[model samples]
Target chain A: MSDAEIAVRDLTIRYGQHVALKGASFEVRPHEIFGIIGPANSGKTSFLKVLNRMDTFTAGMHFEGQVEVGGRDVRAWRNLYALRRQIGVVFPLPVGLPLSVYDNVAFAPRLAGVRAKADLNVIVEGCLRRAALWDEVKDRLNALGSLLSGGQQQRLTIARALSQKPRILLLDEFSIAVDPVTTMRIEAVLSELKAEMTIVLVTNLVQQARRLADRTAFFLMGECVTVAPTEQFFLRDADLDPRARDYVEGRFG
Target chain B: MSAPPPHPDTAALDRRDLAWYVDKLVAVLVFVGGVSAVVFIVGIFAFVTHEGWGFVSEHFSLRGFFGSIRWAPTSTSNPTYGALALIAGTASVTGLAMLVAVPFSLGAAIYIAEFATGRTREVLKVLVEMLAAIPSVVWGFIGLSVMNPLIIDVFNVPIGLCVLNSGLILGLMAAPIMTTIAEDALKAVPDTYREAAEALGATRWQVTRRVVLPAARQGLLAAVLLGVGRGFGETMAVLMASGHAINLPTSPFDSVRALTATIAAELGETAVGSTHYQALFALGIFLFVVTFVINLSADLIVRGIRKT
Candidate 1:
């Protein structure tokens, strides 16, 4: 079998005495859409944060077990910059930095030592195009990113994530601040993005998972209850654990 | 559920009775107290300008006031009141103070806000507050007794009382305020900016330089402006540490006198209504205008930053 793009084994996360995730393990295949659906505080965001080591910003966060990307152990990597550069994350809210729209998308590339103005222009335009935000902001590239509409800001953030040229993209409720039309546009963008990199999508909207995700995981409390292909989970006699079936059916969360 | 019993005495009192009148009376008194502060500031401005009216009416020459280098106001023959020397002195001392204070306080602010954690940050904050609480007279004494000897020995100068000496003391006085205000500004930047920057592979230093500082630019600018205002108006420390010479400072080591120091040193000796006294009041007017312009420009810049 081909190696998993991301492999996790008994990943446990804690904030002081509070356990955020309890020995959860999963794998995501390359070029596939992996959806994580859970109620609030079920560790979906925490799990995404751990992928790019963004959780280090939180005080008193403790982690156990292993997370490997492309067969390399994440913890063993000494250069966090190089590791994080390979993975991108989009947050729930659209937090456009207080910078020009063009500069916002060009930020990552500039950080990675891309100094040529021509190269930056290409990267910024290309990323904006892939995020489906190019037409709306093409004329206002010099305008402040904070001035963009909420939906446009969300797309700008996605464009910024793409600018990193990440191998894996983790999105946490990216459509929460996005309208349905923008959401549909982004869903199309995601379908295109999966051809280039693996996508880990954590969503509150279960229907988003049904439409996009090739594989789905259900989380409850702090435990990942099940991981199955999307079609099998939707089947009536799908051999899923009864609780997973009830959750998928909207009987109880 | 049963209704709770009401107090008979409370029930008899109307909402708009004596208690309400007392509340309104207290509110008006507090409002008047707040307004009194503005009144006092305006009153001082008016009194100074009124006393200095003679200089404005008769002796005011833009060239004589600002063009000449000498500041021999008490000369028996000519009584030259040229402020060019004094202005140069004030600029050099205050500029030196800013040069020393800005980098030090900004670094301290960033360290306290972003790098220091928990017990360290709390202890540093308390220490900074204590530094701010130290009286200007105490700082002046320290500069005179301790810093003077050290500067004399190190630089091998004939005298330690110079623009550099006054500047260093003023810088110390401004450091605590600048650091405190700048730290508050840096801390006010949302955690989300840091998180987003970090997720994009930014190191902590990079995030601080690129994201945090730019986000807090307006507040940081205000912090620098307030520091300048504090240094510009400082008197006791400059009066003690500076040599009180009315000469253009050629170098950081040259003896000089600031406007505030001039006012502090000579105001007591000048008679009530002499041209010298009026000139001093005129100096007060200049100081007020300079500080007002600085603060107003800073406000404009902050507003401009917000509009972007």
Candidate 2:
């Protein structure tokens, strides 16, 4: 419990009578990339929602069992905002807020009470640089964020997520709207970020897990099918769960 | 593999059927329906200008019409048709109405759009729309009977049928429509923006203020403008509540007359082709132009939002 940055024990998420994820148990170690690969409707997004208590606002979304971030259960935090500040989330599609590009990246920092113009300028530039977007957008940070290309907007979203300086970053299929080259650039950014915070990368691309995750978990049909170190998880004759092996090998989603 | 089936005859496939005729007929009908709106607007404008033209050419002077405050058209030896007082009265009441309506409507819109959920949201929306449906004459009755006494008693004014009374009535009358439009504007902001801001640790208020309100700014501005238009064109309520006196109101406590009220009150009594009658038509023309400008600007602002 002390060693793990995020610990889940028998976590189940239900939307009314429909169970989205069931009895999941896993741990994400501090400063490590933990990938969750699954097909559509496999509950990967729902899992990410529970990590930051986002389920609270979702109608009829009920959660059971324990989800701990930093040795404390998420529900135990009296202030939901405080809990969310520790965990940043990127959605399946890039959502460029209806604001200027500079304002979009500065949003989280402003919320965290970073009021100084100089301080905000620094954070906005630093995050945009790390997200690999500053060079392209520096000339026009005053432009509306939504006016940017899909790929640039995705990088802006990443910059926004990083602005909060979260302890855990959750990305749910962030590459869906981005180009391959930009996706590669973001992958590089995430690899570098692994040293600072825990990351839960939920992706449809299975090979992405092999490339970035220190340990990868395969989710299938609302269940945590397997969680293993990357080397052991992809070994040809490692006696893995057949579903995990088949899914990873492009046999079936 | 096997012998191909005969192709369908191109002439048979291309033949116009009953459905095609019906579709053409419907299109023609819809086009007429759309064009009729523009026709009616032009017709109304033409009629108002035609009726007011005699007075404009014969008796009208720019200084007397807009600058002078003496509106005495039946003074036997010296008939002056100055509308400065009426214009001032209307402007004062509409301005006050906005002051009252903007805050109330925006708060309700924010509540219904952001905080209220499920049955509460639905019920609140329906209630706001129902409030909008309450007749202006009924609101005038309330202003006359209910608000008049309340204002007199609350402020210890000698008379309550003043700018304050009518402004309050007009504000209440305008708020429901404003709230409905403002709620729609707020709802038009995508939910993904909220989710994105929330994920970045922003509280609900912070998200609404920083993201939702800014996104909906143009729509909200249009809503407020529409409310101003509603206040301007309102006749019965302002006629009943505003004391129907031609005065340049300097304070809320001063009784004032509005442009619409003047026409509604004076048009029937005056001779049909007389200078006074045509002058009332002139006021009608003024009201028409101002409201038209407000509505057009609101429409343009809403359209500007869509282009972005």
Candidate 3:
């Protein structure tokens, strides 16, 4: 079989009177850095939420398609916690828990039923180092999470998500609120993470997708216009849709 | 530039400086008023201590207090001024009240804030506020006339008013305040926190417990403390349903006396300078101190939450 880890087929989601995903379809390959490029208000976040059944439009609304992850219907799964353990999410802004930095990273694993102190310490340390936050927060892991600076806190959030050893990392504009230098560092970290986990980044930044993503999908007005190799989608004339070109070229109505 | 050569317009500068001086004076006056407002709370403690000082220290005979079944203040006999029985009665009633109040209050708060639809939430919110506004006396009368007789008959108890009577009355009264404050606290939690947890595939119950409740822990604590304070200090409801007995209550069906009830019932008949009168004053002092500690603890928790 092919190595695609997740596939969405003709997924249409609506909330009462509003449609969030209109016949959207895509596939994410294993260990790939795939970017979902969209302008603001394009319903990209909603589509991502639908992957984990976190969409608010679940009741009184219908989905007209199937989302299969690892050859299983995403909806039919009983071990949702285990499934979620293999898939983590980082929100746009840093969500600082009212807990200490150590507890923040240790949260998911503990929830995943990792109770032993030695095991938790190992997982926390490994994830923090992987997220490149250990050096900065190594000594003050006992400090409250809100005490960290913005970029550092965002990195801490990623470490917290990664502590569960997820197979796919869903990042919704993880570095959008950070400085340019910090954003570049996060971009580098994403490239490193791409070697082990599938990284699906939902970003409004067209240039960052151009710079890093191997395959990019362009979302416009709640529809995926094109999904192609990043270089061809950006450089080749025929591979680009008019809307995609407009967005990539910085022209929006 | 030497401050731009004094701005070249000394008279204009002087006018601006005078206005600034007047503003500073007003600001200082306001600051002083703020400080004195804090000092005003300190003064309440002083006033209570000044009048009720020795009465608090004057020891009552525990033998006379517990042995004598009669607590009446006759014209000739020495008054058997005992609050031990009254204190025991108060603890039992309030404890039962808390048992009924806490869970229902928290459940109502969770529903109103997290689960209820928008219109339903609004209606429930208004109803809770209206319940909070209902006079304690009105609630007392309702309990005495409507609820007391029903409970006595349902349980087939001898006392028409019992510990359960006071508990049910105060529990109903305290529910609204707990629900309102707890809802506000739960609502204060940012939406993004819930979204993040849900995205992690946590069930709704898990999200509520692990994320929402922990996030609102301080607020929930404050709500419980506030409820305890209210149940402890409530006079009218307790007076009406507590049966006004100055003896140890043996069961939930037994009549009881609380601190507020003892003071209220006995303060009028005792002579002005008698030990009996001062002991009632001492009970008032005791109630005040208990409520003060409760409120102070709530304040400390709230401040700690704010700092975090």
Q: Estimate each model's TM-score.
A: 0.94, 0.97, 0.83
Candidate 1 regions off by >4 Å?
Answer: B1-15, B302-308
**TM-score of chain B as predicted in candidate 2:** 0.96
Off by over 4 Å in 3: A1-4, A13-16, A57-66, A78-83, B1-75, B115-120, B141-157, B268-279
Cα error of candidate 1 at position B266, Å: 1.8
Q: For candidate 2, write residues A16-70 as lDDT tens digits.
A: 9999999999999998999998777888999999999889779899999999999
Q: What is the TM-score of chain A in candidate 2?
A: 0.98
Cα lDDT for residue A64, candidate 3: 64
* Model 3 docking category: acceptable
DockQ of 3: 0.37
Tens-place lDDT per residue, model 1, B169-225, is 999899999999899889988898888888999998998999999989888998899
User: What TM value does chain A in model 3 reach?
Assistant: 0.94
The per-candidate TM-score of the B chain, in the order shown, comes to 0.91, 0.96, 0.87
Candidate numbers sorted by DockQ from highest down:
2, 1, 3
lDDT of 2 by residue, B1-308 (tens): 99988777868788999999999999999999999999999999999999998999998999989999999887899989999999998999999999999999999999999999889999999999999999999999998999899989999998899999999999999999999999999999999999989888899999999999999999999999999999999999999899989899988999999999888888888998899989989998999999999999999999998887
Best by DockQ: 2
Q: Output the lDDT of residue A47, model 1.
A: 88
Candidate 2, superposed: residue stretches over 4 Å from native:
B1-15
Q: Give lDDT tens digits, candidate 3, residues A32-104.
A: 8888987876778877777766654245555668888776767887776566667888989998776799988
Q: On a 0 to 1 TM-score scale, where does candidate 1 land against the true structure?
A: 0.94
Docking class of 2: high
